[model samples]
Target: MLSNTIGETKTARNFFGIHLSLSSDMLRFDIYKEDGEVFEDLAYRALKIAVMATKRKQIRNLPGYYKGVLRKLIDETYFKDMFMYFDVPLGDFYFPENYEPS
Candidate 1:
């Protein structure tokens, strides 16, 4: 349902990307609604899961990480129904790889 990426100053608003930063404490976690995209509850839930997934993996990163993830997900699965992104637990739009904390 979620995967990849990191943090430094210990703040989370909901988001990530690739290049999991494993050395910073400040991270970015803000997601944006697409053009004409109606962000629903499930969508937010999916984001929540994704964020938790990142934390579980202990992934870290700088700004733009959320944007990067969004871009990658769009390339992977541009949802026919925007809420569909939340259909199967952040369905299809997933982090390319999973990172397990060490």
Candidate 2:
């Protein structure tokens, strides 16, 4: 199964924020927002189960699940408003890129 490359730890201010460890065998995943034992592992477990089920069913698109999790964990309205600002045509703001898409 895929290992280290699939596992990632996000940190901020020298403190671990969230850890997303993915296992290839069954789409198993672990998310640790902080250190120590967790009393609420169900959320992570549920996500793992969903991912496993989706993979077994030959489903590829999982953005909806990601979006749902993000929306629920963050301020959806505020994030959407912030995202809209970034959706403007790039040509209106930045110069041409030095690198071209293959």
Candidate 3:
């Protein structure tokens, strides 16, 4: 799918980020995403889930803390907040798959 030209839609992916879908045989993606939108979405969902699953004490979203934490983990790896989200730290929350600590 190469036309040796710009705006060709050859791959549905560009510098700004993938913003299109593909044929059903190859794959399928129908979301317009920027660099860290996915991470932001996931982290927010994780924090929400964690806050919801908290039954002992009322968990508060302290902006000064949680915002920084979520920003720090945004682009490091996939499923980085799995432990925090699921409330099951397998002893490797700080170090997820192929993710180096900063």
The estimated TM-scores of all candidates read: 0.29, 0.24, 0.26
Judge candidate 3 at residue 89 and give its lDDT: 60
The digit string of per-residue lDDT tens for model 1 on 1-102 reads: 232232432333334222223101112323332422332333344455556667667655523445455444443443456665555764455464675546
**In angstroms, how far off is 22's CA in candidate 3?**
30
Candidate with the greatest TM-score versus the true structure: 1
For 1-102, candidate 2 gives per-residue lDDT tens digits of 112322433212111112232112112324323422231243344345545667677645443453344334334322347756776786677655785657
* Model 1 regions more than 4 Å off: 1-35, 38-46, 79-102
Query: For model 2, what is the C-alpha lDDT against the true structure?
Result: 0.38
Worst 10 residues of 2 by lDDT: 10-19
Model 3, residue 93: distance off in Å is 28
Task: Give me the runs in candidate 3 sitting further than 4 Å from their true place.
Answer: 1-33, 49-61, 78-102
Using lDDT as the measure, what is the rank order of every candidate, best first? Answer: 1, 3, 2
Error of 1 at 77 (Å): 3.0
